[model samples]
Target chain A: MDERMTDAVLATEELTVRFGGHVAVDRVTCRFRAGELTAIVGPNGAGKTTYFNLISGQIPATGGRVLLGGRDVTRLSVAARTRLGVGRAFQLTNLFPDLSVLENVRLVIQSRRGRDFDMWSMAAAHADLAEAAEAVLERVRMTDLAGRKVAALSHGDQRKLEVAMLIALDPKVYMFDEPTAGMSVDEAPVVLELIAALKAQTDRTILLVEHKMDVIARLADRIIVLHNGALAADGPPREVIASDVVQEAYMGKALEDV
Target chain B: MLKRILSGDMPQSRALGLILLAILIGLAFAPFLFPGTRSLDTAARICVFVALAASYDLLLGYAGIVSFAHTMFFGLGAYGVALASDGMGRSFGALAAGSLAGALAAAALALLVGLFSLRVRAIFFAMITLAVASAVAVLFSQLSGITGGEDGLNYRIPRALTAAARYAEEPFLGMRLTGKVLNYYLVFFGALILFLALLRVVNSPFGRVLQAIRENEFRAEAIGCRVVWHRTAATVISAVSAALAGSLYAIWLRYVGPDTVLSFEIMVDILLMVVIGGMGTMYGAAVGAALFVLAQNYLQALMGAAAEAAAGVPGLPLILDPDRWLLWLGALFILSVYFFPTGVVGRLRGR
Candidate 1:
């Protein structure tokens, strides 16, 4: 609703990704404004995750460029992009299985704080790092499980921990790939509430690839519907759900309430 | 007492501190209690290999990088000290300076090797290091004028570090202060300090990242950690520690050769030490090195006596004979692996 909030944007210009004869993601152009939560909804194998990967620099783009805060970042590495304030959570839980919850969050904080290469100092001796990690954990309501090993945590808790890690990195743009894929119906709302809480914060951009239409409808300001590796619909949630093309491609039963 | 000083927040840190303390006391009192040159010699060898194996653990256990080029760096260190002694004349200053140079050279070589090779996957990285290591060994063996070819270089060390020089005339604790005893202390204190330094390095914040990378490199990269640079640093530190051990070995034996220092056998020995002692646990490196060096040195004699006793027994002598010691060693290695999968430390920890 605010014109100033729309000034900062991340856009893809004619992006394409091809694997031999098949194209995983076709040429697509879109923009996600700052301080807004945009949902990318599509069926399985619809290139939603792949497109997220392309923008996050996890996979090389076959053509076109990714603009991060208006700077061309197609050639930047995954780590370089992360340093430039791009954070992502995987579809599968990619975490340090052997490390404790506190340690897992602390590692991300340590890297962001520029202490990853500190050879002479002890990790525990850094009071500020612990405080910062604990602060993020507190925000995610995971401080009680800080000392627990990540492998022992439930799947929902692990996802929450991942969100905690992203908060520790404090990125400008957050890319969440199926953050609640494995959570039960009861557990899913907890994650949704966390995401909603983040969405309420000003000047933060979120690109979420979620399969739950209810989640997309509740939190998304704009919805980008992808079908067969191409952009089929891009507009507000209500307008996109009403579109016949979206209804035929993906919004069959999921958009019944709308 | 020393355990309290070296203990940390890590799991098994107290155990590591105890092992280091035991090594300190055992080697310091070895010459007095055993009262022989052979015992002193064995103690020095154990100290050297302990340092070498622990250095290797920094890479294999912490960084999760398997390298076959370890002995090449060891050889470089030995050669650095041996060649320096030959040119500068044996003195404390010369030996110290030479060892420093040698360690630096080894670290530099590790940096270069790691930078180029660490970009590949784990298995390919191992193969490339193996290839490069073999080439370096060949180069050393061929360069007869400088490296002494296959015969290797034999040079004198400082008098205080030699087995011939006597530090005192009167006996202390029923042990004579011969060159051997004095040299034993030199190697003992030097190896102790080096091992502890490496321990400090592994317990530091940087070592935490190294272990994180070991657990998951992709996640580490995703969190903005530079995997290659971290691995390169670990490799360099490991190489430098190995070089220190190699320098001590060169001074102890008063010789450095391709077969003795740069051979694949030494690298395999280091690997066995890590595996048997427990990879990742620094204390395990010391335990593994001590057990292996002692076994390699005396197992044949023990088997020889057994075979001689069973000479009249038909099939018994064949398997237990000293001449078939390699078979016995192979069996022991397998038994260790099967029984102590986590290593000796792992077994002691009841895991």
Candidate 2:
């Protein structure tokens, strides 16, 4: 355990955030390592999304530190954290609704290359960025819809575009907030396969906050469960699933209310 | 060649393309086509407004920043030139110096505003800009010695650009070959180049980032584009461009006053043009500015003619009264906004 501690790629030390008197994420202390896919499971308002927000620099932590490769990034902006190799995909399918799908992905590619601020050069003039964008879209099988406006895309396609943008960034730590929330049966498999491919690399950390237990069972090597803004369980997926703390935290409360 | 010039961002609609071309040709030969003092003045005003409106569009349309401070930047340019010409004497060097100074000052002030307020909510930022703009307007009027206070500053330009200096012995192409014609061309070409530069910018990588930010700022930040910095950069560029347009307006009028250049009405006019023409496209600025200026200048005369034609026709004559032209203009604006929520260009483009 002591030796494995040093190998952690991403770690949070007692991270917390408060909304007035209420705490959204409370003292989430955990170390995430490369070669691991950790699924964060929780009931609604379990602070799972808030924890992800804390780690990804969406909301500043009220206390404690977020360490990326042992360096504290608690005060960094979201873009600064992204530059430090942290990437995030939103639960809400955040995208450039007015732009074409190709331009949407191309913008991220340009940003990743640090060429987004080249004011004089035409974006179309840079064929390389477009080609790279196409390649990422191809991975998500969205090449046919390249010219389609994002607003015109179906919900599943928008989710695919969201993943394509994240792939374009190619960050070291992938933070996905409900990657397949609204995906259909067929669409979910495509996204799951892509996530599997990323996990196969085994040199980058993947953090997923999800409600789908089946997905957590299939892809997650380890599971971290949160209940009422506190960690309830953390261990191998099966052990964490069977743990009494998990059952009592959300399940028992839900059953009692029912 | 034209495609290259447009940076491959075509107007995308044939009718829109033709309309833009007609506007281009008409402005290019305005003095020759409509040879009169009032017409030339109207044409000059159109050129300056086109550039001004387009620069404002870069913020309101492309980047989705609501800024009322645009006229403040324009005022800075006008005053920059007014002071330079007033202090440095009538010379080409003074014009150049004033124009450059105005652009720089506008850019610097925009940078400060963006840094301080961009991180706030969009509506709040708009309020902040409104406050800043009104403050600047007040400052321009209060600083009497420097800005000429309420009376305003009347300055001269180089002999070559004034109406007294005739370049040729005879009028050419039914237009006098005087310094005034040269000044008109200067305004026309400067506006043209500035409009094209703005077009190119909207097609660039930086411009795409701005669109993305407008679409989803949090996602842009999550994807590694510093949202605030990008917004600030866009604000500076828009301010500088507006300042330059203000410089051209000052040169054309040979006077600088709060009412002439820095008025809030100018800002409201810019908003109307962008919305009426189309918000997101640069061509919208050209079309919107032309149409609005034409209506403002000629709509009353056209109404007077109609009123006379409808003499003793009950409500028709009363409705067509020249003094009530603004009522008709308001009705037209409402009709357009109702029929084309995306503006004329956006509706014409069919996307």
Candidate 3:
């Protein structure tokens, strides 16, 4: 990875998001470097998803600022943030169940292509849009299932389709939450390969929240550990995993349940 | 091949072309097949309800928000036309402006309601809308001066095509519209145009994001979809459609009243049409409307003799009356909920 790419694609300055009385994420500051795959690892309730939410502008931060390419976007709406080149994929699959895989990708591509409000022209006539969606499908290895309904796809394939959707947006930064949550051991490697390939091919920054340490160790260029809504450790995988606090956070009897 | 066609990957243009062709053929030949006052009247009524049903589907089916207050918008449009055109002697343009005013008013009301109610999901949202509808009905009943109260407002039929003919100096398209046939074609064609426009909107990127919001709002927001805006837009669009249907009803009946506009029956009928036809599918609205009208017509005919025979029982209300159709409609709703959860057409499509 280029050292200049570490100038930061997305950065948070003491960002805090509170839900009623409980603080979901507390004064967490971090920077996602461009062209690098960064992993946020923590147990359940550690606020990894909430942090993602704040960065993506899905939810407003109670305190501090979210900077995208050095521009403060704390008050921006989700769509506005998307327009600024932030793409997100949810932990649970969010594809339109009735629409086919190709249509799902086509919708994202259409939005990116800036023809969302075209009422008179037939969307099917946009051969370039279809080709763009097809390219994303091929990237995710979902070209074979493009014609199939998303509901008909297996759990792993659906995840790939979700990735395809994000790819169609061609966003500068991608935030994925639990990308391989329901995949089998055999299927997990395929997704890992896709993510690796995505990182190698594009200068886009990747922020991932994952539980599978092996997958994290394999893909993460840097790892940030969150425990109880605060950053516990930050460094390379070897350095962070060896920290006593990180081990205690994971191996503690009470924490083990999470 | 059928699976591929039904998969929604097939461009909507091709499917829409076939549907439009079918509708054009049907509209062209329908007058000759029906050739009678009763048949024409039924067909016109179907068109009116189809438009109303399609609007309701836009909200409940596609947007996944059940709004029982839809009939309030419909009623407002009817009353606006009555008050503006009939009461004030305004022209067709004024009537249209009045209808648009009513639609805007409904959109404002929906925005207010959605601000609080949209926070609640599912049955709670439904209850809130129902409360709004009931409250509106009560207000309309109490405000007799504006709504014409129970007696309703009766007036002359507004000249729809005659003005067009006079302006263009066309010979009324060679058909005397003094009968119901012309009204049927007019409403049917209007309904067709509205349906096509809605189909385009639903297939657009805007509609896809709205569906994504419906599926998972939080995720959609995370992905940069403005969930509130999309939902509100859907509500406003639905209100406009309902308002247009209301104006058409006022024109067709040559009357407007609190009973016609503010009735719980209209809301229930719209719900039945969307649910029984299919929720979410474009054609579900038309299918539901057709089935509902057909069932009502036949059921009333069948129950007339039975009600007459049972009239000697003294206290029993006439089951043959159109008002009594609610009971059967409620039964059908329950049946649809249990057996055909997705709707009749939805079940057939195996969705």
Best by lDDT: 2
Worst 10 residues of 3 chain A by lDDT: A249-258
**Candidate 3 stretches greater than 4 Å from native:** A1-6, A18-24, A43-45, A58-60, A118-121, A211-218, A241-258, B1-32, B88-128, B158-181, B305-339
Q: Best candidate per DockQ, number?
A: 2
Better of 1 and 3 by DockQ: 1
1 against 2, candidate with superior lDDT: 2
TM-score of each: 0.94, 0.97, 0.82
Question: In candidate 2, what are the lDDT values of residues A69-142, reduced to their tens digit?
Answer: 98999999999999999999989889989889999889888998999788887888999999999999898888
Q: Judge candidate 2 at residue A145 and give its lDDT.
A: 99
| Inter-residue clash pairs, candidate 1 | none
TM-score of every candidate's chain A: 0.94, 0.95, 0.92
What DockQ does model 3 achieve?
A: 0.35
Runs off by more than 4 Å, candidate 2: A247-258
Q: Mind giving the per-residue lDDT tens digits that candidate 2 earns over B1-351?
A: 898799788989999999998998889999899999999999999999999999999999999999999999998998888899999999999999999999999999999999999999999999999999999999889989788998999999999998899999998889889999999999999999999899889889999999899888888898899999999999999999999999999999999899999999989999999999999899898899999999999999999999999997889998899999999999989998899889989998995
Q: DockQ of candidates 1 onward, in order?
A: 0.70, 0.83, 0.35
Worst 10 residues of 1 chain B by lDDT: B2-11
State which candidate, 2 or 3, has the greater lDDT. Answer: 2
Predicted candidate 1 versus true structure: per-residue lDDT over A1-258, tens digit per residue: 345324756888889999998988999888777778999998999999999999988899999889888799999888888998889888888889888999999899889988888876556778898899899888777889999999999998888888778878878888888888887777677778877877888678899998888888889998998888889898889899888888876977878875
Candidate 1: regions farther than 4 A off = A1-6, B1-21, B305-317
Worst window of 10 by summed lDDT in candidate 1 chain A: A1-10
The CAPRI category of model 3 is acceptable
